[model samples]
Target: MGSGSAKTYRLAFNGTAGQYFGIWATNVALTILTLGIWSAWAKVRTKRYFLGNTTLD
Candidate 1:
């Protein structure tokens, strides 16, 4: 491949069910406690979690 050529990276998900469930459970609890006001924050948190666990290599 030429130096100027586009490179490809593999996308991998390293998040485990147990780890995700913990985050989800916390988000759910907080959302309920805040009367759904925490849903937006929960969404951001979930997205960040997923992104953080994903790898590009």
Candidate 2:
């Protein structure tokens, strides 16, 4: 058992994590390459995906 920051956590493994990482990496690469428009989209996707996948009390 854990408390506070030590509380146990697990990945939902909804199976899109790998794809998310791929999108993240590709977005980062494109951001660097494009001087950063991809960053805006990446941030939006990341926020949406994170909120969509998270479960909280």
Q: Highest lDDT: which candidate?
A: 1
Q: Which tens-of-lDDT digit does each residue in 1-57 have in candidate 1?
A: 567968799999999999899989999999999999999999999999999999999
Model 1: lDDT equals 0.95
Alpha carbon lDDT of each predicted model: 0.95, 0.76
What TM-score would each prediction reach against the true structure?
A: 0.79, 0.55
Q: Please state the error at residue 43 of candidate 2 in Å.
A: 0.5
Off by over 4 Å in 2: 1-16
Worst 10 residues of 2 by lDDT: 6-15
